[model samples]
Target: MIGIIGGSGVYRAEMLEDCKKEEIATPYGRVSLTVGSFDGKKIAFIARHGEKHSVPPHMVNYRAHIKAFEILGVERVIATAAVGSLRDDYVPGNIVVPDQFIDFTKKREYTFYDREAVHISMADPFCDEMRAISFKVLKDFEHKEKGTYVCIEGPRFSTRAESRMFKSFGDIIGMTLVPECQLARELGMCYLCLAMVTDYDVYGEKPVSNVDVKRVMAENIERIQRVIEQMLKELPEGRSCRCSRALEEAR
Candidate 1:
């Protein structure tokens, strides 16, 4: 089964058929899951910030969430993230499929290899196959095929200086996707995130604000939903990458 993790303003996939809510318990903690079928294929959905958008980036139980997906026999994950644009090319209301990522997260649980020192390769963090499929599905839109995403540890927005400095590091900025992306790799599950630019952080001429962030996300969510549904429908089945064998050597 394929799994979908919803970010800000994307609580559930209203387009799914026969969807139901269920409770799941993991080694890390318990979480709620929405399961159903999309285009005749089984899919499991999870709200990254809870169903009500309550959890913050630093506090999210990424380990538990990934663990739950594993237990449910999920093979690949399609994650949605609301991010800030750090470049002019990636403007607000654009949907980006980041093929590279840099971690700026200050505090958060990073891995599940607590019993041993496991160093999984960070090269090409997102699934290449998934990223390719995403671009094809969203080709007509203002889509960026590949870009660098800097994941910050935040419930707070970045300062002007901080945001400006990050412009050198990545094309887009987001609070989630750090442990979330790395954790999926450790579990050998294919993972890819669709980064939706909600605003131009502090790098833009206009100052960043929560109200503006919400407004941009709200406006572009429907388009994102369309892309996601098409992605789920058109994604090719079976293995095409090393994502499934991520722990082959590390273990």
Candidate 2:
């Protein structure tokens, strides 16, 4: 099964057919996921920020989310996130399949092996095979294949100076994806981010404004829908990568 984690303004997939909600219990907590079929393939969808968009990034139950996917027998995950662009080339209303990530989050429960002190390798965080398939699905779309996404600890957006500092190191910025990506790796699931650029952040000369979100989302909504549709259509049934073997070295 393929798992889809939806971000802001994307709580549910309209393309899903015969959808039914399943509330699952995991070792971490409880999670409600929507199970449905897309093009005869089983796909599970979960809203990372809750169904009503009430949960903030720093408060999301990353453990339960990943655990729920694992319980559902999901082998691969396509995570959609709304982000702020740090680099000039990562413009607003663009889609990015980030190949690297830098985490700046603090005081969050980032691991599932706290009791046993297990260490999971994260040298290559995102799954390469899944990333390649995602890029191929969006080949004709205005997308960037390689970029470093900086995951911040935020209920608040970054200040101009902070944004500039992050821009010096990364190409895009977002609140989620830190523990979410890492936890998926720990659970042995193929995870890839489908990052949607919502703004240029506060460092841009044009001054970040609240109005840009609606504008960017509206302009790119159709494209995002198409990208998800195409990705589902092309997603493979079996995994050939090492993502599922992540726990082999855990101690």
Candidate 3:
């Protein structure tokens, strides 16, 4: 089954007919999930920010969410995130399927391999197979197919100086994505992050603020919802990539 992870508004479980909620327990913690059929295909949908958007980015249980999908037999996961733009090329209201990620998250549990030493290769953080499929579905829109996302540890927005420093390293800025991306790979699941630019961080004339981020998210989430719906309908029956074998050589 294909898994879709996003905010409550972006990935609606009510959109599915005969929907049912299921909770799974992982070694890390518990993950609440909803499973139903969309377009006659079985799909597992979960909110990245908890059911009511109560969890902050830094407090999210990345391990539990990804592990729940793995235990439930999901082959691939498509995640939608609201991020801040660090580059002039990517502006608010634009969508981007991040091809790479830079982990700057300081105080979050980043791996499931605490007991064992597993050196996993992260040459490409996001799944190439899913990225290709996302491009096809969002071709009509002005979206970026490739960009580097810098993940920060935050319940707070970035300062002007910190934001400026990150501009040199990445194309976008966000508070999540680190452990979520890595954990999926460790479990041999195909993961893709579909990011929506929500603000210009501190790079813009006005320093980034929660108000602006929420405003931009409100404007662009519907568009993301439509794009994701179409992508789910067009996914191939089999994935032809190395995402599923990520643990083969590493373990």
Candidate 4:
């Protein structure tokens, strides 16, 4: 099975066939998601932010969503996030499949093993196979094959000074992806983030706005959907990446 975790501007799984709304009970809370199929692969999708974009990034229930996918037997996950570009060249309307991430988030659960010591490796945070497949499928699009994501704790955009600091080492900036990505690794689930650039961060001397982010994402939503669809059709059934073995050495 496959999973799609939709972030800002992505509220539904319109590509899934025979879709049905499902609500699952998890240790954290109940999670609402849609279940369907495409290309014979069962898909489960949940909006990272609530459907109406009411849930702020810092307040997202990262655990319950991952737990819901686990309960539904989802193996690989493709998540979408709208981000601000840290560099001038990584312009809006482009897609970046991040190979690394720097977690700057605070006050969120970073792991599921709070009761025990389980240190999972995040050296290469994303699933390599999924990254490779995404690169291939998005070849024709204006996409970056690799980049570093800086996930911040936010209900607000960054200050100019803060944006400049992040620009020193990150390619893109967003409010989600930390605990969500790491938690998936703890459960040995293959995860990938398809980050879409919405605007220039304040480091570029242009202030970020919710209006601009929504506009960019709204224009390119179809492109994102097509990329996921192609990936679903190309994804193999066997497990070959280290993602499924993520917890083998974690103790």
Candidate-wise lDDT, in order: 0.89, 0.88, 0.85, 0.93
Instruction: For each candidate, give its TM-score against the true structure.
Output: 0.97, 0.96, 0.96, 0.99
TM-score of 1: 0.97
lDDT of prediction 4: 0.93
Error of 3 at 138 (Å): 0.8
Clash pairs of candidate 3? none
Error of model 3, residue 236, in angstroms: 0.7
Model 1 misplacement above 4 A: none
Instruction: State each candidate's clash count.
Output: 0, 0, 0, 0
Estimate, for each residue in 18-130, the C-alpha lDDT of model 1 and write its tens digit: 98887889999997999999888889999999988888889999999999999999989999999999998888888999989888888788899989978899788989888
Top model number, lDDT: 4
In the range 1-251, model 3's lDDT, one tens digit per residue, is 88888852464644566789998998889888898888878889989887778888888888889889988899999888888999998988889889888888898887888888787889988888888888899988879998899999987888888998999989998888888889889988899888889889887988888888778887777688788788888888888989888887886
Error of 3 at 232 (Å): 0.6
In candidate 2, the residue pairs with backbone N, CA or C atoms under 3 Å apart (3 or more residues apart, or in different chains) clash, namely: none
Better of 1 and 2 by lDDT: 1
List, residue by residue over 1-251, the lDDT tens digit for candidate 4: 89999999899877899999999999999998999999999999999998898899988999999999999999999999999999889999999999999989989988899998989999999999999999899998999988999999987899988998999999999999899999999999999999999999786656999999999999999999899899999899887999989988999
Worst 10 residues of 1 by lDDT: 201-210
Which should have the higher TM-score, number 2 or number 4?
4
